[model samples]
Each structure stands twice: as structure tokens, then as C-alpha cells.
Target: MLISRFELSVARRQLLHNRGQTLLTLGVVATSVTLIVFLATLIGGLQRRIIGDTTSMIPHVVVSAPERLPLAPWELPSATAPAAPLFVGRVVKLEQRLRKIEDWPAVVARLRELMPGGVAARVAVAEGQGVVSRESNRKPVTLVGAVPAEFTRVVDLQSNLAAGRYLGLNGGEAVIGYKLAADLNLRLGDRVRVLSSEAVSADFLVAGIVDTGIAVIDRSSLFLNLKDAQSLLNLGSAVTRIGLRLDDVFDASRQRERLEQYLPYEINDWMRDNQRVLSGIRAQNDSSRMIIVFTVLASGLAVASIMVMSVTRKIQEIGILKAIGAKSRQILVIFALQGLAVCAAGAALGCAVGWVLCDALGRIEVVVSATGRTAQLFPVANEPFYYGLAAGLAVVSGVLASLYPAWSASRVDPIHVIRGQ
Candidate 1:
């Protein structure tokens, strides 16, 4: 106990004797630790928001036909001469598009079974192109047909409505995207004409306007009753796709593989479907890692430089202690303990500063371009693990930096270090 106390006392005295160098070393360590904590918190928050926004915009897995192609005609039109004055040329043959998925309920049931939870919701959907017109304004949109209740479980359609209630599939009501409505100057209860490629036109009451916070979806898609879409597209009880939402979105690939046995359609997982957004998140992660590496390296260099200077200045004192019966191990412990003390102090101060910086970041608004949304405040993850991780890194850096200096101090020769001649 006496030896330990003596070693600690010497370490404290040495730090106090060179207060400027000690403080500078501490500041460098603190700055490195602060950057680590700040980057981790910011990146973690950004990842969550990005993933959540992207996932909510689409289903975890989508089962659909690979392509919509023209089917072979059952019977060729007769080459008989036209009986009317308007029919002067050959008759046009009708070609049917083959893309509808039959018996989707069985496939959906099998998919739900393959998921972690058997309660995962799957919805049937049919898609086609149509022109939405409100007076002179007309724009092309992708029309999606879905059952309202089932669709709500597959995506956040009901919760993100900007105006009016969600479509109940009754009274021929339809839901339009906010951007589409804005372009058409449409309002709730307003009537709009939607025409399909088959020249099927109908007046639908605008029941709701949804702002999904995604530019593409909001500007190019709208929703209608499944029955209405089937009728308009002349599809008899057939759906074009099945959307499944899982409890854990990361399991989409596994679930898709399992679902392959139940259906022959192409299965697209969310990760593959939103590769661009995921790539952005990955890029941010890579940049943060690079920053952390440089910060840690800089901190280690500062610690090493300060420790080397401290050992040089204390060489005579170390020689005196050795001549007075101090062991090399004792001298080593003194320097190591000094390094640990510096790390502890710096880590504590860095954590406090990091917290303040994170709080400030949380108050600033960030506009996510990919999502086409502006967050009121930046999201910050304040988990205790981040601080613990920063402290651990600081400890490792301090110990590694102090080793050479501590070894040099232990190897001091009394004869050479103490000679006045």
C-alpha cells in the first residue's frame, strides 16, 4: 500500500509540474472522444430515420409477375371484306395482356407462415396506368387497386393521409396522392375522370389525399378499390401483385426465399427494391468510420508526444529514484497510472461536451432529400453504450501511447542521468 501511494503521489506531482503539457494532452484526447460520440450519435439517428421512412413507403416483400406481355390470340380475325364504308382496311386484332396472378390468397397464406410471426399481413394489389383529369389539367399516374383494410396493414397508407378519410372502397371513392391532387387542383368530394388504356373512363369521388413524403410515389401513383380496378382493367378476379409486411424487415430476403416454393412469381425484397437509399446510408457510415480512424490516430499521436517530453524532463528524477532502491516495475506503474488518469479526466470532460453538442444537433432541422421530407429536429440517439465505447477507445489509445515512454523511464541509468560533469 505504501509503495502504491508513493507511485501515485509521484505521478500526480509530475503532472502538476508540467500543467500546460498535461492540459494540452487532455484536450486532444477530449476532442477525439467528443468527435467519436458525436459521429456515432448522428449516424445512428440518420440510419433509423432513413430505414423507417423507406420501409414505411413500401412492403418488406413484393410478389409480382416478371413482365406484362401480350398473350397469343385464340382466333385470328377473318379476312372477309368490310361491309361498311368506314372499314376500308384490314381489321385490327385484339391482344390481351398476361400479367395477372391467380389464386393469390394461398400464396399470401404461405408467406405469412414463412415469416417469423404468423400474423404478418399480406395484401393483394393490381396495378395499371391511367390518366387523371380535372378540367384541362391531366397527368399520367400509376393506379393501384387494393382492399382498404388489408392495404392498411401492408403499408402506412391510412396514417399518412394529408386530407380526407382513407378509401372504404364504397361509393366509388378513390384516394389520390397529394402531388397529383395539387397538379389537378382537386379537393375532397371533387369528381375527377380516370381513363384506362382500354378506353374505360369513369368519374371517381376523391376520398383522400396521401402525402407519403416520397416524391415519386406521391406524384405518380394513386389508389382505388380492388374491384373497381379489376373492372376497369377488364381483369376478372385477378391481382397483379401481393405485398407482405413482416415483423422484422431485415428478414425479407430469407422470407422471400421461403416463399419461392409457394409461387412462381418474382419476389422483390425491400433491400433490393430501395438500393439507392441504402447506398446513401452505407456511404455515411463509411465516412464516419474514416473520421473516427483519423481522430483516434491524432489522439494517440498527442498522447505519445506529451509522454515522450514528460519522460525526457523527468529522467534525472527517475535516476534518483532508481538509485534510492526503486524497482523498474514501480517506475513503469507510475507512468502508466499517469496515462490512465489523463484518459479518465479527458473522457469525462468529452462526454459532457458531447452531450451538449448532441442536444444542439437535435434542435436543428434536417431535410432528407431522398425522402422528400424535412425533419423538425435532428434525431439523436443518447444510449449509454456510445459513451462507454468512447471511453474504451480512449483507454486503449492512452495505454498504447504511454508504453514506450514508460519503458524509457524504467530503463534510466543512474550513472549517466545524474552526472553533473
Candidate 2:
């Protein structure tokens, strides 16, 4: 029901008469909203930072050759009799040979067409296991080969370089991880011999040292030219896999599903490999939501208590209005308007305070790792959606909390109240 001007005026006057109480109720509501906004922004920022760091150097989706499997016993041909049932014997697992995608260029082209703007970058990679040695010091490493320009777009190798330049277009140049360099007692411009698992060996100049902050990659990863790696691994014009970075990291799983429909290659996304991290992030979000719900409910109860007291104090006033031919609905509307006004003001104030808090906290920097390798400011997601959500919840809570107290005020009997009962 719409509140008339007279009822609104009466509500305004009543609220102003008890300025201190009204302000206190507003402060309670504002505090609840502030907490909700702060928690939501903080949790969201942390999750983004975690996911960003984890996927920084990795591809969101990987397309590779599917695993080869031997035929089942039932599918085997019967040499003795064409119609006779095949006898089942002991089953033996066949070792998979070298896995490589020969038609990777066509696959990459197809991915580009299917995804359009969804894929930010894609690169074909020829990778293999090899051992790098400098004199007596030796270290095993996973060697990756790709075009420098294209690979950097996918893996961001340029930004993560600790020393020297990334791989050049020429052969006989290698980029080794800092940890691997340290283990081999190697330095920039130092000569090292890398022997592939297939017994192919080549000498290379250490063109760069990269420290990606990921322990496994930093310790055992190496980079070389596509031709060099392919030659070393004994793969003729074939790439082991194609890596794709998406515009939205979260779209990895959906893109993977879409690609798997038409592509014959095996497809994998980062989300599939990081289930534990995803679970932890989801848990944090769930806890934050629970806390926000309880906070708003507590604030609603506080508003209800204050409104109840207001109704008790103004019982005589309410009776006087009813005796003057004022309807019970009008009395109810007056109080409900008071509740809405307080909540609306409180929501505005709370949004301002929450933004200030988030901004201040975002400036405080902290070291993320013990090695002092990386430092970052506190993450605070400044999303307008959070502000809107908090305001909406507060307003709804206010309306609901006002109902019972307003109903009680409307039920007051003018005859009994004026008779001193």
C-alpha cells in the first residue's frame, strides 16, 4: 500500500524526535553492511590472486594426441576358425610409443575458428625429457620447444625471465631454469650438453635463466627452438601438444568440452587438473556467504528490537491518531516508512565506509613467499555487484523487521489506551 503524505510526515517527525535511537539503529545496520562488503571483496580478490598465480605460466587448455590402446580379446581375429569363439588368455598391457600430433596445424586452425575471441593465444609445443650436463654436474629436465614469439604469448616467458634474453630464432640456443642452472653450476653464455631420452645429443649456449616461482618448473624445465627440440626428440615435424590460453581463465572447462566434440585429439583444461584448488576456493566463498547471512539477520533483529521499543513508547500517540479517525493501516505505514528510511540511509553510509576500508586495505603490501621472491599488495575486489548486493539485503531486512512492530502498533485500541489501560 502507498503511504500518504500525512503518514510520511508523521513518521518523519517521530523519527526525528528520537534522533539518538534512530541513529543507533542506523549505525547497527550500516556496520552489518560494511562487514558483508568487506568480506565479499576480500574473499573474491584472494581467490583471483590464487588462481592467477597458479595459471600464470601454464595454458588454460591443452590439446594432445590421445593415448593408444590395444584391441580387446573379443575383438581379436580367430585364426583357427572364422566362426569359433575366441579363447580368453592372459591380458598384457602394451607400452605406449612416442606420442605426437602430426596434424597439429589443422587442429590449431580449427580451435581458432571454433573459439574466435575466446582464445587469447595458442602454440604448438614439441616437448621431451632430457639430461643437461656441465662438466661433472648434471640435471634432468623437461625440454620444451616452440617459436619464441608464439610461445611467449601463451606462457609469458618474457616477463618471468630472471637473467638474459628469452630463446632466439636460431638453433643451438637454450633457456634453462634458474634452479637447473644452479644445479649444473652453469651461467649465462656457458656451454652445456643436453642428451634426449632417445640418445640424441646437442650442445647449446645458455641464453637465459628463468625463475617462474613454480618450484617444479623452475627446477626441471628447459626451453629450445622448435626445430632443435623436434630434432633432439626424434619427432619428425610433429608436436607433442598444443597449448591454448583463453581470454577468460574460467572458460577453460567449457572450451574444452566444445573442442572435444569435433576434435579427435585428447583435450584437457586447467580446471580438470586443479580440483583441490577449486574446492578450497569454493569453500572460502561458501563460508563468506554464511557469515554475511548471519550478520544481516543479526542487524535485522536489532532493528526489530528498536522498533518494538518505539511502538511501546508511542502507544498513546498511536491511540490518539486512531481516535481522530486515522485508519490502522495508516499507523502501520507510518512506522514501516520509518524503518525503510533508516535502512536506506544506513545502506548508503555503509557502502561508502566499505569502499574506504577496501581501498585502504588494498594498499598494504605483504611478501607472499619466504624466498622474498614475490611481493604484492593485499587483494580487494572492487566489484560494484557487492555494493548492490549489500544494499539490497539491508533494505529487505529492514522491511521484514518492521512488520511485527508495525502490526502491534496498528492493533492498539484507542478506547482502552485512552482509559488508562
Highest lDDT model number: 2
lDDT of model number 2: 0.88
What TM-score would each prediction reach against the true structure?
0.77, 0.84
lDDT of 2 by residue, 329-386 (tens): 9999998999999999999899999999998988787764333445447688878998
Give the per-residue lDDT digits (tens) of candidate 1, residues 347-369. 88888899899888887886743
Per-candidate clashes, comma-separated: 0, 0
Q: How accurate is candidate 1 locally (lDDT)?
A: 0.81
TM-score of 2: 0.84
* Candidate models: Cα lDDT each: 0.81, 0.88
> Could you tell me which 10 consecutive residues in candidate 2 have the lowest summed lDDT?
367-376
